[model samples]
Target: MRYAVIILALLILVVGGFAPPVVADAGADTAAGLAAPAAQTAQLGQDDSAQTTIVVNVHSDTNATWKVRTRHSLRSSEDVRAFERLVDELQRGEANSSLDEGMFRNYAELAAESTGREMEIVDVSYNGTVTDDGTTGVLTMSFTWTNFAERTDDGGLRVGDAFTTPDGGTWFPWLAEGQQLVIETPESHEVQNSFSGIREGSVVATGPMDLREQPIYVVYEATPGPEPPDPLSLELVAGVGAMLLLVVAGVLYLRQQEETVPQSDTGPASGSVVDRSPDDLDGDDPDSGDSDGGDDVDLSLLSDEERVEYLLEQRGGRMRQADIVKQTGWSDAKVSQLLSAMADEERVNKLRIGRENLISLPNESHRTNGDE
Candidate 1:
């Protein structure tokens, strides 16, 4: 019996030795399975704090064009390499493997380079180091693409639909901090229906999309604004002022010359000379032109001042002195002198508002159809 037992024990030991050693390395296998994914997660966390900024410029000319500029801030050399690989994968239409293999294939080109019957990429620029030296680095890229569209029709632009990194996460992933999208349009075009409702001229701005697996879309509709008025130039104003001054000076000089000329003493030509003093002349005295022969004056014969007075009566009895100069095409000095004379003669009242003068005809002065 002892010998039979010995033989059975030997048989058991032999079977044990021949069987596979599954239990011996089970712990090692489990640890290896857990360590790989954890290491990958740790590597991704290093570069998850980077930022991205994008600028889009839309031109709605004869052909609509779109210009896109993207800037990425990277942290380490591993992050830089990861981004480079991501870009390559996107170029080959190998991105977003869970979707159709080539789903994001054309996306990078749209922001980098693309050519087709409906759209064309006119220019592209990519700058930065492939690897950062253990510190933060920057990567910048830009591309301009064009699409055929009617110039007169309203134009629209869209950006930001896909947001993902290639290395699954061990690479440079987009961060939301400082992420902004700026859209600029033509001068006469106004951007409407923007995400943020913040716009200046034709430029529109919005904050970055939240960090998520889903894509974000930004669309803008542009329409023309009212045609701008012709700009007033300093040179034109100066030229008009100089011309008015010459005209006023010439008229004054001619009047002065006429007054200085001597008159003939002999007036009777029929054979008898009627003796008369200078005061007896028909129109020599200034008092003869007055209506009441008192301080009441008549401005009917003064053509320049009369024209200004007529303008004031037409413009609700009041107008700015600068406006008067513009309306009469006269110099500022000439308008000021005429307004001062009218004010002194009590024909018009002048009120000063800040640095400007407003002139109005007197209440007693009524518009008469006879001379105006």
Candidate 2:
């Protein structure tokens, strides 16, 4: 089974185009010009000293809004350290993820690349200042997207110029694959989102503007062409196909074995055999456990790194510490203390990078790097 997994992984290497454990890789130098947070960082400042802030209370009151994998929160205080592990891996000679996902970094790295452009994050408070009542908080990020084809500062490609987009990426085929759709929030905000194009293409799409995805290479995607298929989707199809083939082969082998064996005309031995059910497989949880089939228990008591790793792994790869704070409303001091403890245990490595409360998930690189 392990060998089969290894082979499948080799196939993924031949296929899955991206790096991981949590990071933005090399070739991802100057996003726009900001210094990539050399170290993964998380900082908390009591912005409004006069007001008493309550740690946000997160409850699994509603399961519909709580998806185990699709939705994620900064699950552990140690995430920043895990994030640092990825940075060290990148600094070392591990170029796997960089080579794979290098193309997309040019855009995502802007937050890390703003070298000299007066970077500022103006957050919206819930005190009803921006609106009538304090029901929402807004996060506003303004920065330069380095390769802005037409630099107003330096003369190059300007407005009214079109760039060619690519077709379905690494995985999906027929569907638009990984296409970008333009979105302008109700508040007159503008942003771009990626689309799968299968259950999520244009014709089926019935809301707002449809902009092209953030291209791996800006020079091309801005224009008109085809979008790339999702890499994960492709891998899924590949994995499924491979698994199905293996199952078929196993079935045939079993048939061959049966034919070779002398017919003993085996009958049911003795008494009735018990068949187990799904819930029976994993023993029933204690009656007092959580209601979501017992999967999500109160994990707050777990140590920082343990909590973070468990949550991120449960999700795919990434998570923001801020998001976790928002969901759980944990205090900065507590969060920091727990994460520090994890660093001491070498379960995670903490580094100062990016802005406040930023974190990343762990990957193989984290295991080898000493926590700081």
Candidate 3:
């Protein structure tokens, strides 16, 4: 069964014009498989219950780590052993010539020629495992492909160009049914745009998809740098300093007036005493009590969620969750719960990038890298 699957894949490659010369001497079953359509051959070679997941992590240097894992339900020990044997053969470089590193190198060379860049495939490895209850078998393979992304003029990355054929035409590698491809962005970068597939924090394409008809292109750029110091903060500090200086100067002037005043020990006459309101003494000026500035929001009047929204607005409608906690002096758990609730309410957007949650106001976009 393993040989048949390998032969089927090789036949598909031959039909697609991407086969290596080492696979030219296929058996009669290969010819028989070739008689069917390439998609049908791929579908027939795999079990209906099997699933394949391909994760491509593109690094900042344009190198990519590819991890391909296939899981199949095993009805008996023979099925597990067959999977183990296939993994062993693939690990020892004795699987089919089409499944070896040379074929990948050939693909990389063609990609390099098409993109006008140097490309190398390295660190190829394989692993196989079975569930402890022996109900399922898993086969895993991984490799690193260097220069798999093209750097843009503005210091961003343009992936998917490396998958083009040397003739500048669309070329899609074979993907079986129940297969999925996940393209992760480099660290400290956020996806800017995606030409194909669903982009929800990361790029994902689920098969059976015809890449030849709809190709994948993803663009990501580094997160924006820290914002400059808030000018409002500086203005507040200056206002406080001016108020303090005025208070000090008034105190000194009052002291000088007391020292310069002549002593008057005469007691007030019995009916000369007058009652006065504080406002009357201060001279009722309408603007005297209006100390609230346009930038100042009375946080004491706001709820916890509103306070968070206010903080996000202060920081250009986006902030890290940790920064929110720090700015609001709230506990981590409290901030997390508040943000989660706000996100559920669609009042705020929370994007988990790496270990932190980037909080943004509704309708406000945040720059972020890959998310898990």
Collision count for each candidate, in order: 0, 35, 2
Which digits, one per residue and each the tens of the lDDT, describe model 3 over residues 1-372?
433343355334323211112333354444344334433223223346767677889999999998766676777666666656666777888765233565567568767888999999999998878889988777677899999999899988889887776766544554546777899888878898885555666788876676667777899887877888899998999999999999999999987654333222111234554232342233433222334223555565667777777655544456678766656655688778878998899999887766777777765553333231
Kindly indicate the candidate among 1 and 2 with the higher TM-score. Answer: 1
Candidate 1 residue lDDT tens string, 36-123:
2222223323333444455556555423333222333445557556545545543454432111111112333332222222444445
121 Cα displacement, candidate 2 (Å): 94
Cα-lDDT of candidate 3: 0.65
Q: Once superposed on the true structure, which residue ranges of model 3 sit more than 4 Å away at CA?
A: 1-46, 97-99, 173-176, 197-200, 227-372
Q: Quote the positional error of residue 78 for candidate 3 in Å.
A: 1.6
| 1 or 2, greater by lDDT | 1
Q: What are the per-residue Cα lDDT tens digits for candidate 2 across 1-372?
A: 322222222222222211121235433333321222222322111021111111111111100010000001122435433433433444453433222223223312332233222222222111111112322221111222233222223222221111121222221111122212221111111113223222221112221222233221111112233668899999999999999999999999987654333222111234734232332223432222343223654553454456555544432322345433433345566667756675577554454445644344445234324442
